[model samples]
Every structure is written in structure tokens, then in C-alpha cells.
Target: MDTLTNIRTFLTVVRAGSFSAAARTLDTVPSVITKRVDQLEHQLKVSLFTRTTRKLDLTEVGERYYPRFMTIIREIDDAFQDVTSSRHRIEEKLRIKCPTTMAIQYYGHILTDFQRSYPGIRLELLLIDRSVNPVEESFDIAIGALPTSYANVEDIPLCPLPRIIVASPTYLQEKGMPKHPSDLIHHDCLTFLAAGNRWQFQGDKGPVSVDVTARVSVNDSHVLMHAVENHLGIAIVASHIAEPSLRQGLATEILSHYPVPDLWVKALVPRNRRGNAAVEAVISWLKNASQPAPPWEQIPLSKITRQAPS
Candidate 1:
């Protein structure tokens, strides 16, 4: 029996959920897949899976062995890639998680460019607006505007997500503009669900927080910008998300003197993937894309800036 081959087949069966599915993934027949798993089970003198006509499930020993097998496979792949990377193109799979708004507005092209450059690598991108546990989700990398540290994950800072207060020209004309963070309380404020009714800022004095009333609250940044364009209310939004509107004169920045606190876009990598070539390459590519300044920040904001609050 080819021990390594049988072990790989066993892992594939576990991941694909059935012999037929594993056969399709491995480009073989169900009988071959079944034989490999059977051989692996016989070698170990234990049953790895409980089979039923309806479904397949792992036994307790199999559950304990899955992670160990995954680690072994990853180590072998990483070692081989590292040795050949200088001479040959990297061939691997990378699973990435990112926030929905950021992916649509900014990272879509960046990711596309990376894939174009490394045609050998396969990318699986999952778009979500919530924090994800990279290890638990089996993702190689997770990107977001995370403010706090997570255990067993290394947060590599990519760039600052500077934000600004914005309102439509028509809305500003009707409701008037906010001169300070405190003025927000009197306006029809739009808030992100994560931020609640309170908005944070930094002034020359120090940090400031204001409790404002929101007629509209949403979790998505793009929708919040749309609300601003529709003259729903004043909102604090990421500078990148608000850039196009600000440039096109659809939206105007308010309270420029009091800068909103910056959220950082970071690459959250699991500890085990620390030295992974593909992960490192992706991180480097992202950092390079943000260099000098992020694409949005690089634009001349001469028109976007409002006169300092009087």
C-alpha cells in the first residue's frame, strides 16, 4: 500500500464528504477512492468513517486525526514550494475572506491583478461583513478593518481606513452642516450598526465621542453612502467608500477639522500559515498596492476638503 497516497485520499474523502465526491475531486472513480480509504483504515486497524446510505460522518479517532493530517499535508506542500519557488512558479490554493464593501469598492481589482500575475495559484474569496475566525473557517487569510487583536492570529496592517463625515449637497442645504461633532446630535444622522448611535472623532484637544440619533441604521458601508447620496442624513463613512461621491460633487465632507478615528485594514493570518509562501506573497502584493498611499488616499482631495469649521 502507498501509505502517503492512501492518507491523501482519506483526507480528500473527509473534505469532499463522500467517496463519489472525492473521486470527482481526485479525477478517479468511486471504487478507487473507496479502496484507498479502506486501505488506510486497515493500515490503522480502525474505522475512520461511519457510513450510511444517506451520509458519511467521521468517527472520534478520525475527528482527532483530521487536523493533524491537514497540518502534515500543508507542511509538505509548503516545504516543496519554498524549495522550488525560486526556480518555478508557485502553485497553490489560497482562501481569503474580506468585508463585502471593501471587496467591491477596492480589493476586487487588487485581487484580480494578483491572480493575473500568478496564474498557477487558485483563489477562493469569501465576502462577509463580519469578523471571521480564520482557523475555524479554514481560510488562509482574512482581511478587514479590525481594531482589536485576535488570539492565535497575526494581524498585519495594510493601510489606514481614514473616515470622514459626509452629507449630500441638498441635505446639507436643508439640514445645515455640522460645525463640530456635537452638532451631529441635532441632525438626522445615519449610523452603521456596528458603530451604533455614537460617532468617534479626534480633535486638536483629544478624542471625542458624540451620541447622535439615527433615523437610518445599516451594517453596510455602500448602503450608508447611498443613503447619504439620497439625502437621507449625515453619516460618517470610510474615505475610500465616500471618495467617488465626494469627487463627483454628489456628497460633501463636513466637520473636516474634527477627523474621524481611523480604522486599519489588516490581513489576519492564522499562526500555522505564518511562513506560507502564498500567504506571504499575497500580503506583499497588498502592501505594494497600498504603497506611497492607498489608491483612494493618493487622489488629490483638494476639492473634497471643506473649509475648517469656524
Candidate 2:
């Protein structure tokens, strides 16, 4: 006999007070209900009902078990209703981790658009550019150029990050341009200390490593960009950040010596929680959004409209 059938028979008989009454309530023959209750008694090794021609009553064993069964049945029904309710309601709190530099650049519009689209979801955005462990940090999503050294996470690539060197035309003209990667040593340079002052490139010979010397150094890319604009020094930075300056003829790109490693805008989500809806939404939006080149790759500064900083 089916397992749930016995449980249903127990519930019906207890509520209706007789096998005949229960069969009428269940729309099944009284004998069928009797057979199911008997099967349950045999499985449990305990008789569940005491019967007479005049009345039906619970056995001593059945009395003890009856309340538990009813409680469990109620719980099961409540659980189903809870699940159904949650499925219809979309309210969820979303938390995300992002690179500090990119967060300041891209997150403003993303958060505004997401809030308008998903009013039911609350968001927590955390900015962490350097090394971060998502599991330790308890974040729902991580956004950055995914590190290859990462372990046990879902790394979803969002966009391409073309990196290159940019310098103010005024600064470049004052110091003069470098003819080769080696010539950079003589010119004033703005550098990223995080990159270890070693610029890796794909050269005609295959791969080349150039250790650049800089007059000024900064850990932050955004600050380095500003330094270059202020004529503090020439800086190597991403194209998108330098787009406005490049358009206005403020900055110029240097030597065709080698190809810089492309930055991959990627999202790192916890492997255990990869199926979350909010994480999926941000990942999808990042993929669909416009991705412009980092300053040094495409059109020169002269073509861009110049807007002075407010």
C-alpha cells in the first residue's frame, strides 16, 4: 500500500469517528480504508484502532500516536503554503563587493537603474579593489577583473578592459616623446606601484618585460590619471577613464612597443550561492551595458569634446 494512503486513512478515521464515516468522507469504500489502516498497524507493529459494531475508538497505542500525526500533517500543509507565498513575493536584500576604483566610476548608474527596476530588492554595495575573499567577507557578489588566483567561485566575465599609457599633451611636449620602451627611463613617468613597475607586454618577439622608472608613483589608478592631467607626470591607465581627456586633445598614447594585458571586467559570485537572482541580474546588466575602451587604445584625444571639471 502507498505510504501516504495509510496516513490519510488515519487522519480521516480520527476526524469522522468510524471507518464507514471516514470512507463516506473520503469517497472510498469502508473496506479499502480498513485494509489501509491494517497495513499501517502491521508496518508499525501496533494496532491503531479498537472497533465494535456500535462505535470506533482509538487503541491505547493509537491514542499516543494520533496527536503527533495530526501535528505533522498540519505542519506539512503550512510548509507548502509558506513556500507558495515566498514564490509570489520578490522582496530580497542584495549585497555586492566591487573594486573600489571601478565602483566609483560605474556603480552610480547601475544602482539607480537597478533600484528603479527592482524596488523590492535592497542592495548593499562594498568596494574592495585589492585581494578579497568573498566567503570570508560574506558578500553576495564580487565585481572586478577576476583574479586567476581565485579558488572555488563562479567568475563571470562582463567586459573587456583595454589598458594603455596616457600622458598630457602639454607634459609630453615639455618632456618630449619616448622613441622606445627603453627611452621611457629618460622621460617623466606616472606609474602604478601595484603593477610592480614592471610593464609586461606581447612583443613581436613574443613577450617582453620592461621595468619603467617614474618621477611620481601612485597606488590608485584614478589618482594617477589626475596626476597626468595636472602635468605631474605621464601615466599608464585604462582607456575608459581617460576617454574624456583623450577626446579633448589633452592626453596622447605612446610607443607601439607591446600589447598590454587586457583587463577583464568580471563578477565573482560564491559557488554555493551562484543561483541567486540579484547576483544574476547585476551580472546580466554588466554584460549588456556599454563598454568603452580604456584611454590608450582607440581614438586620439583631439576627437573628443572637452568638458572642464566642475
Candidate 3:
């Protein structure tokens, strides 16, 4: 067995958690992945993985050896890059992870423009709704809003995304507008699970928090927006997600005088991989794309002429 190739295959299987998934990632068959793992275990004289019908788990030796193998692989790739990177103009493949909603709503053009500018670079974008750990997943960079800080990753802030409270004109008319945060209890609320059940706002005196009773709670902003459009309830969502509705007059802003917490869209890269050329290039593009005014705030609500859906 070729030791380096087998090691890489083994690492992929470990991270992917299944032979078939690893095979798809590696562009090979499951038999090939299985053979590589078998060969590796044979050579090492230890069972690396404990396989069952449901899932594959790493054994004691495999757990210890996994990090060591990863470090060696990274070092080898770095050495190869150090030798050939200077001769080329970013002729490398970049694996990027982003939220599905953001990719569809905002990042499509930015990514396409980058690809056009750098023809030599190949981009693989993975759109996932859940949180991702870039280092564990072996992705070059992960782009999304993070709730809190991560010690293992470096966060590069790109833009601010303010959370806003919005309701359809019909709903507000039927339920009456909330004069204060305390008034929210009397209204139907649609909540985003990513933002906790409690909603926070900055009032004239200080901060005001409301423990809301949700009519419906969903993880996807698109779904929540649809509910708001139908006059089901008021929703608190990131400004970007609510921009189209708000601009079209499908939804009207509530609590206009109060301030909501702002969430920033940031690039999260492993601390050790921050200086990689391809990663830095993408980050630079994102920063430039959001400058002066972020995409979410580019068009004022008053400028939108399209009528809201009935």
C-alpha cells in the first residue's frame, strides 16, 4: 500500500463517518476505501475502527493516531505548496462552507465574480444549514453568522446583520401595533430557533427583553418569512432575510424606535490556516463586497416599487 495515499483515505473515512460517504468525496468506490482501511489496519497491527451496522467509530489507537496523521498530511501539503505556490497565480482548489440561505440570497454573485476573476482557482461551495467546524470538516473556510467566539478559529467580521421585528400590515391592523416590548405578549409571534425564544431590544431607558410565546418556531428564515407574509404573526429575523419582504411592503417594521441586536456575517477559518493565499483572497473579496453599505441595506425600503404579495 502507498502509505501517504492510504493515510489520506483513512483520514477522509474518519471524518466522513461512513465508507460510502468517503468514497463519494474521494471519487472512488466503497470497496477501495474499505481496502485502504483494511490495509492500514493490517500494516499497523491494530484495529483502527470499530464498525457496526449503524455507524463506524474510531478505536483507541485510531483516535490517538488521527491527529498525528492529519498534522503530517497538512505539513506535506504545505511543503508542496511552499515549493510551487510562488510560481503560480492561485492555482489551487478552495473548499468553502456557507449557509444555504445566504448562498442563495446573497453570495451567488460574489462567488461567481471571484471565479471569473481567478480562472485558475477551482471553488467548491457546500451549503449547509447547521453549524460547521471548518477544521474538523477539512474545509478551507466557513462563512456564516456565529453566535459566540470560538477559541480554535479566527473570525473576520465582514458586515453587520441587524435583527428586526416585522409584521404584515394586515396583521398589525388586526392585532394592533405593539407600543412597547411588554405588548408583545398579546400578539402572535413567529420565532427563529437560531435566535433564542427570548427577543431583546434596546429601549430609550435601556435594554428590553421579551419572553415570547411563539405560534410557530422554525429553523429556516424563508419559512418564517412566508408565515409573516400570510399575516400569521410577527417575526423577528435578520435584516438580510427580511429585506425583500420589507422592501416590497409585504412586511412593515415594528418597534421602529427601539434598537435590536446586530449579528455580523463573518468568515471563520482555522487559526493555523489563516494565512493561506486562497482563503485570504476570498476573505478580501467578501470584505470589499460588503463595503460602504452591506448588500442587505443597499436599497432603501422606500425605493422599492413592487407591490407586496396579497
Q: Against the true structure, whose lDDT is highest?
A: 1
Residue by residue across 176-259, what tens digits does model 2's lDDT show? 887666676777777876555766667787877677777878666767777888877666788777766677777777765665
Give the alpha carbon lDDT tens digit for every residue of 1-310 in model 1: 8988998998999989899999999999999999988998999999999999999999999998889988998898899887556423778999999887667656776888888877777899989887788988898999988575678999988888888999999999998878889988889999887667778888999998999999899878878888999899999898877877898899999888898889888889999999987888888888998775874665433433433211
- The C-alpha stretches of model 1 lying farther than 4 A from their native spots are 1-89, 297-310
Scored by CA lDDT, what does every candidate get?
A: 0.85, 0.72, 0.84
Which residue pairs show backbone clashes in model 2?
238-294, 238-295, 239-294, 239-295, 240-294, 246-301, 247-301, 247-304, 249-301
Q: What is the C-alpha RMSD of each candidate to the true structure, in Å?
A: 19.2, 15.9, 20.8
Q: Which scores better on lDDT, 1 or 2?
A: 1
Q: Which tens-of-lDDT digit does each residue in 1-310 have in candidate 3?
A: 6989999999999889899999999999999999998998999999999999898999999999999999999999999887455425787898898876677666766888888776677899998766678888887888888565566888888888888899999999999999998899999999887666788889989999999999999777788888999999988887766878888899999998886878888888889888877777788888888775875566443354434333
Runs in model 3 deviating more than 4 A are 1-88, 240-244, 297-310
